[model samples]
Target chain A: MKVLEAETYQAGEVHRFEAAGQEFVYLAPAGGIFGISAAAAAVLETMGAAGRRMDELRAEMRAAGFSAGDVEEALEELIEARVLERPRTLPPPRQKMPERFPLQSLVMNLTNQCNLSCKYCYEYGEDKVATPDGKPKFMDWETAKASVDFFLQDSAGRERLHITFFGGETLMNFPLLKKVVDYAEAAAGAQGRAVDFSLTTNATLLTPAIIGFLADKRIGVTVSIDGPPDMNKLRVFANGRPSYDVIAPKIRELLARHRTRPVGARVTLTAEVTDCIRIFRHLTEDLGFQEVGFAPVTSSQKNLVTIGSGKMDSILEQFCALADEYLAAALENRQHAFSNVTDTIAELHEGVNKSHPCGAALGLVGVGPSGDIAPCHRFVDSDTHKLGNVFTGIDRSKQADFLERGHIDAKYDCHTCWARPLCAGGCHHEAYVRYGDTGHPNLHYCDWIRTWTDKCLRVYGAIAAQNPGFLEHFERRKAS
Target chain B: MKHLRAVNRKAVRVAGEIDAAAADVHALQEGAPPQPKPVPHYPVGCTIVFSPGWEVDSSGGTAGLCQPAERDLYDCYATCFWPAQVPDHLNNYPDWTKKCASATKDWREIDLVFP
Candidate 1:
């Protein structure tokens, strides 16, 4: 039926608030906030939070001490605004989702082998999920090549490819990393394509030659460092020796040498290290890392080390202060070097209506040491949730199961959620650990994300209004 | 479920009776909303920019594809045409004038304070 003035429209999950002394309604599905008049607010109040026929609504407002002229005027404004819509029963798909996985980034677990025995290391931690074989691991040349070949075969034609090296310690299998880089780059070049290389490492084994090689290759590197020595108590070497003193210099060295792409510092926030501002400052200002991102430990193990719900508010409070600093700098047209805030706000600014948290089960796959393919790097060692292996091919049935389960369409709770458009159901890894099911949404962090998103939205609003020119950098970033 | 907090609100040039009523409404609600919110404290000269990976659009959701040109205190819609990915997303906000657009709908308005 064509939308007519007579039709009743139910209010969807809308956020109604008064700001700057004006009544504003945030239509979630439409992603708009309109500053309605006092008369309009009174008209909406007559609607009694439920939608009704315009004629009936007019009568209701009339009964509520409103004149017919006022009611008609409000109706005209509301209908013209499309604010009173036909009551969204179905969420509009934000983007055309890919049916077949267009493989781009393949995380290769070169070796489960590690030189460190950090308390917070997931693979070595209390809640470590064992590989199927239940054996200590390392990827062989054949397995690694098959993983590359699988991405190539399955990649539905892409010009650029990404291969991220992962490990108990990636440098433990430096030879494999070198081989894959050499092989993949050559293959890409042969196909008139290109490849980007990146790796996550402990930074304990960075030799000058290795750093030079990485610098020459222009591969992005993410060093896993928590914070200052006192804060990084959980990140210890195998012999219970402090690894910060060793890695801090390596991080500085990496940042100083790497120029093509910014080297990022990754900090895992646990109960052992909840200091957000200090950690961020130490990494960016002290270590001179170009960017830094933080993540609370997602381990399922019940322990004092796990970041419980109580700590979330405090951590988020500290995070908000830093985000403020980031915003303050942006308003002044200065970069604050806060990668997480920068990244989160970037998505909000772009209107990224995400249908899933990350393209974990979509554009990328994680290859285990033994050549098995899982949904992502976090699930590489899980007995269940394993998609398939490169040796044979992806188990389409299993992949479908994950895709169906992980899609926002399948999450019942997300249907009416205001933040669902962006969050899509937090991280699959977090969901699995927190809820014991990869398909479930990460409920533990829901409030945190919602509040954080609101905070970022406000920051975006302030920046967009204050310094409109600074956003040109976002476009430049894409072109680069 | 949403109520304005009197303490949090800074009475930005609204009429007298309504402002007092808004404060009364807020007082009825329990506790206060989160603090250090995105209240625009920066003055007129502070120029804002887009965060990385984001582009200016006329609207949000499926209709959020129109590229916007940066104006002195706001971003204005440059082209009437929608992005190829969202070819149909044009003039989503019926309440606004034709060329007006915002980064997102989280703001109260899209003027000098939030565009």
Candidate 2:
């Protein structure tokens, strides 16, 4: 906490806005937006444009007609909050990762072949084309086996581990999934470790047998469905017919059969659909999913149907509406049907502050259909971002490069952004897709994120105050 | 504006690590899930393997890390990767286990102290 000096001081990025007839300065670095007298807002506005000496600032404040006491108190408050701080020179960068890295998760891209061609699909969601590296569409069982072995061995010291089967559709390669499950179980048993299995599927290809198998093996499944038929216009069969009708019954069947573990519904929100509450209702209330989450379409490609600035406010408003519903349900000791609300609530319930948006290059690596390792599932098809191959092991330099790019300091704007800790430079892959540079943070959604987070914070405060017992449900949810 | 309170910040951390301990004791005594041992915070699906080979107490007052030797067959005394209590994310998160990938070490910490 640098104290503002009377001799000299620098103002960080302080966003000044007038909301609800009150003057406010949102100090981004401090994660505080304070309502101050209009005079104080004027002071911050002037000072924030450039660094200034204290006496010069006072003179400006006085000329602007602010009283000595108000100006003094305003400066005191700003300095106390670390909004105004001493300027400093940059320090040399240090190593961003450990020399001996710990491997905790292996995301296996079972195959690149998919039956459904969703418009928002990042992996050339355009066509059944070869991978960006021009590799074959399917992963060989041998490569998959080796990758599993590597994670179990490399992450041996870890008491528990997870293997996520990702792909064009994991069920597209059911045989490999089964074989890997058996092999992983045997391997974990030998290592005295526990391995949990999860998969993200489109639900177009799931049959009774596959659902039974997943339930039998206790593999958690997350079905990708936007909403009712009209909401999922972008998701279609390879032949270009809407897939909601075809996948809906399959999803219901999956929910009915996959009894061993909870089945979550994952909805991808594109520019076409910002009706969050409606989609959430259909997924959880209408469809009976245990939980449901939403991930906005991330590709910045011109051809993709990505969410734009126009829809973010409506999306945020709808999310807050659902959050209110989540609060109502939680206070009554009932589980909310909305996964997004529940997830944010859980984080707030637990006070989770993340520095990175996710565990991409750290312990979690996404193995492509071939033997290649990418930063995460999103980067699996991106050749440039490929960190290494499973058979060859991680290319420390490339992996380290991607990891370093994600370091908060490496991002120019993120260091000063109040949301840096949780946004973690936004999604690394999103940055790569948008700017063609992995180090950049996607500023496109920064406003939406900050606004959404603010809503979550408010929701947390309400639930914590009204229903303390609702938090106990965390234990039950964790157990369930 | 009121600042964030410390207690509210760390509420229900590791499901109150103590409550979990009590539940574990209750389960051993009642041979049922009397109270659930709080959920450990190693993300969902990850398990913690505690250190083994503990010296047990022959007497059975309470079977714990070193409580009752007779009841101490499986209870982990030393630390396990999966701590029973979740770290208080607000106050003491970014524990030794690992930092969330998004959290980078701020470079400013390396600068020399100035008067």
Candidate 3:
């Protein structure tokens, strides 16, 4: 079944093919087959064998004293049956993956180096280790420039670009970080594009100067704070002292400086469900942060304990209960928004056809010190998802094929399931590191996404009932 | 007697010069009763005059004299009535009869009548 001829449309393409005993119509690009009646087919033949514009065909039938309405209905039936293909420009022939738009965030690790040595840190993880030298390294200015250039090329026509600085602590390499941001902003301006900046920091190195720079640049910040001092014991420095006292004051100062900008917290769940909820509440209610997100620490080789489905279920239940609390707080405050992972899940449920829900790994390219481009910051060391090197620039031709290989060979079982489109086969790096294959769907994350989706629909309904106009405005903003 | 004369007039006008092969193919394709030989009726210079109140039956399924034998009638009717429906006001004449009288004054005319 080769497509001998095809006409592309915005909705989908249509192709005419001869297979088995008869001629068949197929929706091209996606490749769904449709069945049209013999009478309708004869009418089509009379109009022209090659093809005619729909309106012209309709008029010709009408002038020839045929039922215009019947012909129109038959055309639609043919379309639905996959007998006719709608016309559309095909994706770039050379690329391995189709271009996906409206990317959510791009994660850029300013430097793989970090100050604190957390037990669960990827740098210290058995799978990915720093060089024998104890000193943390930084990304040079030239590589950073190339990274920005690569991003602009890959993300052409994307509505907004969010550059999220990550690392051991992105703030530790402040000079190179500033230079990268400056170059990106300048490049974006030259191309007439809009770019937003964000950072996920431990908040240990945040100072008055750092706060001022972030505030001036309008960078959204998410600080990592596990629980109170006791629960945060796992995230300690090389000297093995608690980091809470050091990070807390800096978080307060940065939040004070950028009151209007979004300042959120991320807490990693290492203990039981009860402890996780306690940590979440303490971070949001006690610390006065508007929003907080929770995630389990990645199961690196150093931490050989497998994350079981039982633990994952308990965490989801706790998170769902916490989401209810967060919603209540937002409503009570009348103007606060929490980093409800539910929103991202809800967008997925709404059938947004993104390659991945966590858009980090696709649109955003992370530059290793050696100038290799990993899919994103998280999978910097993994060979499976390493897109290409930035020095040669992005080979656009290989994108589609590369993505197809990743999708097919992904270890995440979810990739084969119907929900694959919504979850995007789960995190590739997480699957590769934990399970030795990217194709396996992380059931833990899948459960979390399902729970979050249900909670979001519930919250969204309540919000819509209270103010019908809110949804309208939100949808409008999404469209624009 | 009047109907026979009308039939003769039509037959005389269309007789002879008809392609025998085309007629044979037409007959074979129809696969029905054989058609009678056509007889030309009108002279070369005679004019056609449609009877007043002889309006075409536009309603479908009538099986009337003016109705077409094909599944569709609009195309046939449009072709048949083009000259008759040419408005008199456009030609500054009192009626279609008057328009035809003035218009064919300088040209030879042929009249067609169907029963």
What is the alpha-carbon interface RMSD for each candidate? 11.0, 9.6, 28.7
lDDT of 2: 0.68
Ranking by lDDT: 1, 2, 3
Which 10 consecutive positions of candidate 3 chain A have the poorest summed lDDT? A1-10
Tens digit of lDDT per residue, candidate 3, span A94-149? 32454564334556667776778776666676755334243226677877777777
Question: Is model 1 an incorrect, acceptable, medium or high docking prediction?
Answer: incorrect
Candidate 3 local lDDT, B1-115, one digit each (tens): 1111101111222222122323432322132213443431211211123212222222211235343222121222234444442223333432323223332141113122222
Candidate 1 lDDT tens digits, A1-480: 123447787554555555334566544554444456666777677666678777677667777887766666666555544455666666576454466768878999888878888887667656666554674388889888888888888885888888999987999999989999999888778888788999999899998889988999999898888889998888887789988888877777877787878888888998758888898888888888888888888777476688867777888998889888887898788887778788876665554556677888788899889888888888886778788888988898898888778888778887777777678898887787667777798776778988887776666555655675776777576554
- Alpha-carbon shift of residue A292 in model 2 (angstroms): 1.6
On TM-score, the stronger of 1 and 2 is 1
Candidate 3, superposed: residue stretches over 4 Å from native = A1-106, A129-136, A272-274, A300-308, A326-337, A345-350, A381-385, A395-402, A408-419, A444-448, A461-467, A476-480, B1-115
TM-score of chain A of each: 0.88, 0.80, 0.71
Q: What is the DockQ ranking, best to worst?
A: 2, 1, 3
Per prediction, the TM-score for chain B is 0.16, 0.23, 0.17
The candidate 3 chain B region of ten consecutive residues with least summed lDDT is: B1-10
lDDT of 3 at A310: 74
lDDT of 1: 0.69
Least well predicted 10-residue stretch by lDDT in candidate 1 chain A: A26-35
- Give the clashing pairs for model 2: A355-B102, A355-B103, A356-B102, A356-B103, B14-B86, B48-B82, B57-B69
Quality of candidate 1 docking, DockQ: 0.02
Candidate 2, A151-188: lDDT as tens digits: 77668578778899999788889999999999998889
